[model samples]
Target: MRTVAYYKGCLASLSAKELDISTQALAPKVGLELIELEAVTCCGAGDIHEAEPDYYLHLNARILAYAEETGADTLMTVCNVCTLNLRQANHALQGDPALLERVNRNLTKVGVPAYSGGVEVMHFLWLVAAGEGYELLKGAAHRGLKGLKIAPFYGCQILRPSKLLGFEDPDRPSSLERIIEACGGEAIDYPAKIKCCGFPIIQAREETALAELIQPIEQAKEAGADAMVTPCPLCHLSLDAWQSKLKAQTGKDFQLPILHLSQLVGVAAGLADSELKFKRHVVSVAPVTDKLAV
Candidate 1:
């Protein structure tokens, strides 16, 4: 089995435990031995934008530092916020020695050694696609997710700064879309496919954020998508966790099912319903799955 360090990003471990558990479960199923890094902190998602920006950079760099210390070439993450923060930090550390030095100083003060940007950051979806290879998953599928109108939400973080992705396309990503198709799910090309989920300004610019995210969600809904599928947990939190708030803000009745890429893979692989943890989501997948089943 291939070994990889699992970085559960702050939101995944705390705010979104369901996705975290699903990620951990999916690993062994796909022939991966997941070693989780201890004392893992937030990937500087919203916190990076607040109080001290430099500290956020160091904190994020520190996580990458920990992953490198384990000698793991690839670090798997589930949160879009965490993936974005870690990848951006890795790029900064690799390009600028001075910046890496300053962040290292912060890391040393905290007893967490500095990182030199060697470890690669990958979302769990990418790990399944590349680490185990798409062929492995396709061979393991017990039942296809037939007739499911799966909306592929790439958001922005995973597909930017092409150098960071190594081989994956940074802008027009097919990583998640391809996975859906491999498992016999219909990957729909909705208009807001690559739009940002307005996650950056959730607290201060909530109204604007809601408008940004809601537009894409509304588009998916109008497009007749059965559910919104994504690899990022914060996109899950913002789009799924805050759906009620989004509904109140928009003053209309709307609900769209959001499933992490891992959960959808579980569905195609014939993993049990409880293992996928549809109940953990703030937005219910019961209606969506029931409809899909019929």
Candidate 2:
């Protein structure tokens, strides 16, 4: 078993609980022994990165401190924002001695071990698809998602800043598509596959965010997608939860069922709907599950 520290961010711990559940269910099948980091706090997602830059250093370093104590060689999270926050912080502390000293100074006062740049941080999707390899997952596909047409949604943060994350070609990432194909599903190619999910500005620019969110849904529908899958919890929220609201706003009813990549993997791995918490979703996933009989 490949041991690693699992960081469940604010969204995964609360709103997107199913992402956490499905991830835990699918980990063992992928040969990952996830070590939960309890003491780790928020990664200062969203506005905090701009409003309070030092807070990310202080909090993320402390989170890494816990991961270091666990002796796990890797630290992983499912949320794209969390992954970006932690990964950027890890890179920053590793490169700049001044920032590391300042962060360590904060850690010492809290009785937490200072981060020594020991653990490598990765998004769960990258860790599984790139690190574990798509073939390993394909070999484990027992109940597989054959005959299902799926569109892969690559949200912004995890892929961008390619030099930092180093997971895939940001312009043309096929890891998610490959993983879907490995799970025995048909991965559809669409124009908006690489488009933004419009999650970040949802609160500030609601109308603009709605337009951005609906663009992918309509494109996926046009491409004959049975469902859309994403690795980011923020994208999941925008694509799954706000889907109908976007319909109401645009007067075009594109009821595209959105799912987390982990949930899709769980189903292909033979996990039941209850195990994946399908009922927790705002938009009914029946459109997606009904086609599962295919």
Candidate 3:
């Protein structure tokens, strides 16, 4: 089993507990032994980055320092925002020796280990799509997705600003589709697959967020997607939990189930629905689960 430092981020650790639970359960099945980072703080989720750039760097640098303490060469994240923040911090620190030295000095003052720019930050989806994790997934998916048509939702963070999180082509990504196929499901290709789910701007612009959220599901539903899967819990929350508001706004009921990338893999690996916490979702995953072969 490949051991790496796991960073579940704020959402997975809190509001999106199911993502954390499912990811922890699924990791071992696919030959990954996750050494979760201890006492890690929020990655600022882009808010701090915009308001206080130095503070954002320190926060992410602290998280990376925790990963370094774990003695793992890689730091794994499940959230798109967290992945971006950490990767951006890593890039900035590694590219500038002076900045890394200053950050290390700050960490030292706090009795934390100085970061040596050793850990490579990676998103879980990228791990599965690009390495031996893919082969392990294929081997472990005994039950398989069979007839399910899963649409891949690669929300903005994981794909955009390609210089930092450039695991795949931001313009034309195929990692999610590759993962869906590895689990024996048909990967539905849709234009909105690469579009934003609008969770970030929801608080300030409800109308705009709803408009952005509706397009992708509408396109996915039209394309005959049984369910849509995303690596980001924030996207899952906006796409799944906000459906009621969306129905209220547009008068169209979109019951399309949104599964976290981990849940999708857990199902394909023959994990029980309860184990994956399907009941927690606002949209019934039954529509997708019912199509699976027993």
Better of 2 and 3 by lDDT: 3
- Compared with the true structure, what per-residue lDDT tens digits does model 3 show for residues 1-294? 989999998888888899999999999888889998878899999999999999999989999999999989999999999999999999999999999999999999998889999999999998888779888998888788986999999999999899888888899999999889989899998898989999999999989999999989999999999999999999999999999998998899979999999999999998866569888899998887778842
TM-score of decoy 1: 0.89
Residue 88's lDDT in candidate 2 = 89
Clashing pairs in 2: none
Greater lDDT among 1 and 2 belongs to: 2
Query: What does candidate 2's lDDT look like per residue over 1-294, in tens digits?
Result: 789999989988999999989988888888788999988788888577788987867888999989998999899889888988888889999999998998898899989997788999977787668655355677666788866899999988888778877788899999898888888899999878878888999989988998888888898999999888999999999998888887677788777778898898888888766678988988777876776752
Which one is best on lDDT?
3
Clashes of each: 1, 0, 0
Distance from true position, residue 12, model 1, in Å? 1.0
Most accurate candidate by TM-score? 3
lDDT of 1 by residue, 142-216 (tens): 577876888899877777556665447665677888888887888888768778898878889988888888877
TM-score per candidate, chains pooled: 0.89, 0.96, 0.98
User: Clashing residue pairs in candidate 1, if any?
Assistant: 159-170
